[model samples]
Target: MAARAMHVLTSRVGEHNAVILSQEALSNLVGCSERRLRDAVKLLAAENWIEIRRIGGRGTVNAYVINDRVAWAGARDGRRYSLFSATVIAVDDEQPDANELGQQAPLRQLPTMYPGEGQLPSGEGLDPPSQPSLGGLETDLPARRISPPAGSPFDDEK
Candidate 1:
């Protein structure tokens, strides 16, 4: 029983030292029924070999700490999801890593914005067009944006 679960656990383990996967996925990785995988998780937790945490329901992913030294791990962030491994990395928001953020990196090297590549910082395209204002005067017009009405489509109904 433990063997099967271990097979599943190790597959999802990573350098971040945390494993978080839904019970169903874990069982699939173990090549056993969900019941058996759950039983194995209980045994491992009871024996102190690992720490498992389950949320409210069955589909919820269970978090694990294989390294016995870590008794508790901070709740993982929702953005840290893994598709193939079913792992959710625990991150320290206080001290963030640029690599970890990747494309979403806050301080990424700005993309090449040559004179005519894309829109300029001022919202004008590389070819800034000149406009004639009301009284035969030439002036630059600021980019105009039109926003939808107050309530967003996602807003709940009253």
Candidate 2:
């Protein structure tokens, strides 16, 4: 389950360490049964590694807040008190298949924005064009090197 939490860590968003995913989705991600997932949740909560804010229901999804001390990806100042504003919800990958009557066929093509509609606030024009050339963009620094600090035992200092 710790491994699963690490995987889900990538999906966390906002200033808070929170993720909104369904039990089924989590179970599938963890390669475990829902029962095992529940048990792991209990253990993690008992260890103060996570907190469950809300359980998913009809028209709702499970909400979880990981202990910032255990795993944090945002600024430290607002982690304790801030609520998640930017959330990325995780759902099952498999879409519902068509039944015998073929009433629920999976959609093949989704609609996309017409060229200029990608801009926010609706009225803004397209962004500036990319730079045409890199003539003046040369860097003076040498290729990056990975080495210990000069004073460290691994350093090449005499």
Candidate 3:
């Protein structure tokens, strides 16, 4: 069960920087009830395998921080294990050039998804140029996919 929960958490790490799994979500993923999930989480917390933080006003939405070192140790000893790193890199928001946007252009803003809003177009939601669909393209032409072989560079002599 612990291994199953860990797998789900790690899979979502890319979408969420910090692995924050709600008890209900964990329960659903592990095929257990909320009570069982809570108990398992408590045990993991006691073993320092995860750090749980309760958010005020957010019902059952707890933040879980995975401890990779402890999880690895447990795995080595044939116990339930989880693997994750808590290290976080600070991102700098400074723009490359202030003058890149001319005075005529309005200040740039981040895109937001409102409740009733439909799915935004791809490319960061920025307006894209209207182009004809490629559905009518000729499919008879041969398509060549190029890639380097295992452990070999593109220019390898061999």
Candidate 4:
């Protein structure tokens, strides 16, 4: 569910490379309750996968930047942070208040996978994985080209 929410948010990082959306809308897009989304987002922010920039105040639209940890890590490694880099990035170490995070039990840590560590046959990252269908199921169906139907209503415009 967290990954799904991440995908929905990261996908919006199109040409601009950064996206801003309300938490409510983002939760709806990921098909999860806002509570679940908030918990998942806090975990992701802690792991440095995404950055939620504070806007007005609490419960507001914060700038969602993907691939932020990569940049922060690069800086620590003596490399300048470039928005054009293909590497994933991080954000500032600022976190929300503990009360906002709730008094949930500590989450178990998962093994980290760096570049060249876990390579798929197609060489893809795991966190922001590109799953086209259910549960990463790959289909062998031939690709189809989409085209508009024969003109009817808009034909008069020509």
Candidate 5:
């Protein structure tokens, strides 16, 4: 559950990089009570799994900084990491037919082939071609666009 909460925090970094997690947020993420969450956080802090930061005038808020080193070290010590091995037989790049290439050379040496614009030769669907726009403006639209009038809601009238 602690690992799951860490994953959630990591995922949220993309949307809210500056987000500071509240005890309630962490409790909800870990499916535990706020007190339990606080205890878990304390344990993690003692182990250098995370760093706690105090915020605001009275230190009413706290933030957690995940320690990747501790997490990866634990994983490595537990033998949870894996190694995969495989052998490539053959590959073709120029022609769509795989058989065109003699099945001798290793597949890793073959140049990668990607689908181009429009449909394939067999009429199968393909991604449409993308055209670059002139500064994101339509070709038929006016070159210069109008700007919004400048004024704040708090502007003073003398």
Candidate 6:
């Protein structure tokens, strides 16, 4: 149950270590019968491990303040000799409606093609000239090749 409490434990300014889970919900979370859960709660109280603020009558949730001396998830100052200020309620209701779930934009339809489909003619895509024309530019001179400097390691490779 402490492990479960850690998930919902609050660390607000004055609500440190408070868990506002319902008894039924806590029982379900701990995987135990409600009777067993009550017994465990009693035991924990006897050992000063926790303090129950409310028994949670109809339309209300059971409130528990875990002893920070034993387990705490908030800053030390918040739980150090502090009192409960807020709660963390867990709802056990039906699944939310699609509208309550919020709106989602529709996905865009992408173009599709089958295998070997939409083939281009063999010479159509090769319209660009293989070698760009250098109109009126001098191209008769041979490319100058600079040889490696003498006595350099690169000269030895040749």
Better by lDDT, candidate 4 or 3: 4
lDDT of 2 at 67: 53
- Clash number for each model: 0, 0, 0, 9, 0, 0
Task: Rank the models by TM-score, top first.
Answer: 1, 2, 4, 3, 6, 5
What's model 2's lDDT at 146? 84
Per-residue lDDT, model 4, residue 150, is 62
User: Relative to the unseen true structure, what is the C-alpha lDDT of residue 158 in candidate 1, on a scale of 0 to 100?
Assistant: 25
Select the stronger candidate by lDDT from 3 and 6.
3
- Model 4 spans > 4 angstroms off: 69-158
For model 4, give the 10-residue run with minimal summed lDDT. 85-94
Task: Give the Cα error of residue 61 in candidate 4, in Å.
Answer: 1.5
**Candidates sorted on lDDT, descending:** 4, 1, 2, 3, 6, 5
- lDDT value, residue 53 of candidate 2: 57
Pairs with steric clashes in candidate 5: none
Residue-level lDDT tens digits of model 3 in 68-121: 423334455565545444432211222355455355567676655554334444
lDDT of 6 by residue, 1-158 (tens): 54443343334214456666677776776777777777777777677766765633472356667655323355675544334444665453522553544456677544444343343224333333233245785236557877789878778655
Clashing residue pairs in candidate 2 (N, C-alpha, C atoms within 3 angstroms): none
TM-score of each: 0.43, 0.42, 0.40, 0.42, 0.36, 0.39
Name the lDDT value of residue 35 in candidate 3.
Answer: 86
Tens-place lDDT digits, model 5, residues 3-99: 6656655665453222355566556767988777777767766877666565455543455555332122236656554222211112233247756
- Residue-by-residue lDDT tens digits, candidate 2, 1-158: 75575466445645756677777777777788878887877777777777665543552346667655333356677554335533546453534442333465687553445443432233346543344335786335557878888889888864
Superior by TM-score: candidate 3 or candidate 4: 4
* Of 1 and 5, the candidate ranking higher by lDDT: 1
Q: Report the C-alpha lDDT of model 1 over 81-102, residue by residue, as the tens digit.
A: 3322226634333235746554
